[model samples]
Target: MTDTATTAASAVADATNLVPSTKAVRLPGAGKLLLAQIRYQVRLLISSGRAIAVGAGLPVILLVASKGKDTRPDVAGYAVFGLTITAWSTYGVRLVAAREDGVLKRWRATPLPRWCYFLGRILATALVAVLAGAVTVAAALVFYGSHFGDGPDTQLTVTAALAIVAVLLVGAFAWAATATALTSAIPTVEAAFPTLIFIYFPVIIVSGVLFTNLSEPHWLSTLATYLPAQPLIDAVTHAVRHTSGAPFLPVRDVIVLACWAAGGLLGAIVLFRWEPHRSTQRRAARIQQ
Candidate 1:
C-alpha cells in the first residue's frame, strides 16, 4: 500500500482500539428506570388537548351536572369513561405511533427492559384512573354535599373509600391492558384510530355504563351481559353503591374484567414488536393507489 493509505489505515485502527470494549458503568436500579418510564408516559398523556378534555374535563363536568337520585351510578360511569380515554386513546395512540415511527425500536436498543416500559405505561394510566376517580369523589363531596348515601359514619366512609380505590385500580389496569393488546396487534395508526372509535361509541353508549338497562329487546340485555364493557361498568357501579352502603354484586364484574385482563395482556405480550409491522407497507400501497 502507499504511505498515505497505510497512514490512514493505522489512524482508523488506533481510533477503533481506543474505544472501550466494556465499561463498568452500573446499571440503574429497576425502580429508577421504571419511574423514568412512568414519567415519560404521564407527560405524553397530558400533552394531548383531546386527552385532557375527554379524560379530565368531561368527567368534572359530568360530576357537577349529574345531580339527582342516580348521581352515584352516573359518577361511576363517567369515571370509567375518563379512565378509558386515558388508556384507550392516550396510551394506545402513543404506543402505536412510537412503534411505527421507530421510537420503540430505539428503546429496545437501550438497557431498559421492555417489561419495565410496559409496566410504566400501565402504572401511569392506572394512576391517572385513580386520580380521576378521586377527583370525582371529591367533587361530589364539595358540590353535592357528600350525599353518597352512607351518611357521615366513619366506618362507611372508610369501607367505601377503600373499595372505590380497589375497584378503580383494577378497572384501570384491565382497560389499559386491553388497549395495549389492541394497539400491538393492529397494524397501522390510521386503521387503529377508526377501529377504536367504532368500538368505543356503541359499547359505551348502548351497552352498560350509559344505558344500564338493555332489556328493550331482551337480547340486547344478554348481549350487554356478555360484552366486556358491561361487567367493568357493573364493577365500578357496584363499588360506588357498596361503598355508599348499598348492596354489592361484583362476582360477575370482577370475573369478566379478570378474563379480559388476562387475555388482553397475553395477546399484547405475544404480539408486541419493536419495529414497524406490515401495516406501514399497506399504508404505502394505499398512498400509491
Candidate 2:
C-alpha cells in the first residue's frame, strides 16, 4: 500500500511538472481586418469590370443622356443617386449572398473577432462607394459641365462629408436588415435580387430621383422624406444646390436617416443567421442518421 501510494504521488508530481504546450497565435484587430477586407474587396472590384464601369462609364453615359436637355443640373443629383442604388443593389446583395453561402459563418468560427469581420466589410464597401462617387463627380465636372459654384466650403463640405458617412452607415444597416429578412424567408441567392428590388424601387420612386419635387400631398412629402432613399437624395441635393441662406437645412432628412440606420441595425443584430442552409441540413441529417 505504501509503494502504491508513492507511485501515485510520483505520477502526480510528474503530471504537475508537465506543462501543457500552447500554440502561438496572432489575431487581427478590427482596423487590420478592415484594411484586409478593403484590399480583398478592391481586388474583387478590379477583377470584375462592373465596379469600374459603374465608377467610370456610367457617369459619361448619363452626361451624354442629359446633354441639351432641360435637366442639366439634375445630372449630378442623378449620378449620386445611381451610385447609392448600385451600392445597395449590387454590393449589398453580394454581401448577403456571401453570408448565406456560409463564408461569414466559417470566418466567424475562427479566432478572428466578428466585429473585425463586419468592420472589414464596412471598410471595403465604403472604399468602393467613395471611389465610385468620386469618379462620378469627376465625370459630371468634365463631361457635363457640372460645377458646385462654391467648392466644398467648411460648412457645406463638413455637412456633405457627414451626409456621405451617414448614407453609407445607414445604407449598410438597411441592407443587412433586408438581407436577414430575405434569407430567413427565401431559400436561394437568386431570389435576393428580386426581394431587394421590391423594397428599393418604391423608395427610389418616392425619393424624387426622376422628379425633383413631389406632386403629392404635404403629408406624403413629409412621409417620403423619412424613407431611406429620400433623405439621402435630399442630402445630395442640398450639397449640389448649395444655395446660400437656403430656407431648409434638411434637419428632418438627417433625423430620418438616423432612425432608419438605428432600426435596421437593431433588426440585423436580432435576426442575422450565421450558418448556411446546406450546413444546417447536413448537420441535421447526420444527427438523424
lDDT (Cα, 0-100) at 72 in candidate 1: 48
* lDDT tens readout by residue for model 2, 36-107: 766886687667767657644665576667666754545434555555555556665666677778787888
In candidate 1, which residue pairs clash? Answer: none
Query: Residue 87 lDDT in model 1?
Result: 65
Candidate 1: TM-score? 0.76
Candidate 2's displacement at residue 156, Å, is: 9.3
What alpha-carbon RMSD in Å does predicted model 1 have with respect to the real structure? 6.4
Residue-level lDDT tens digits of model 1 in 137-200 = 6666666564453333312255666766776777677777888887877678787777776777
Clashes of 2: 0
What TM-score against the true fold does each predicted structure earn? 0.76, 0.73
Clashes of each: 0, 0
| C-alpha lDDT score of every prediction, in listed order | 0.70, 0.61
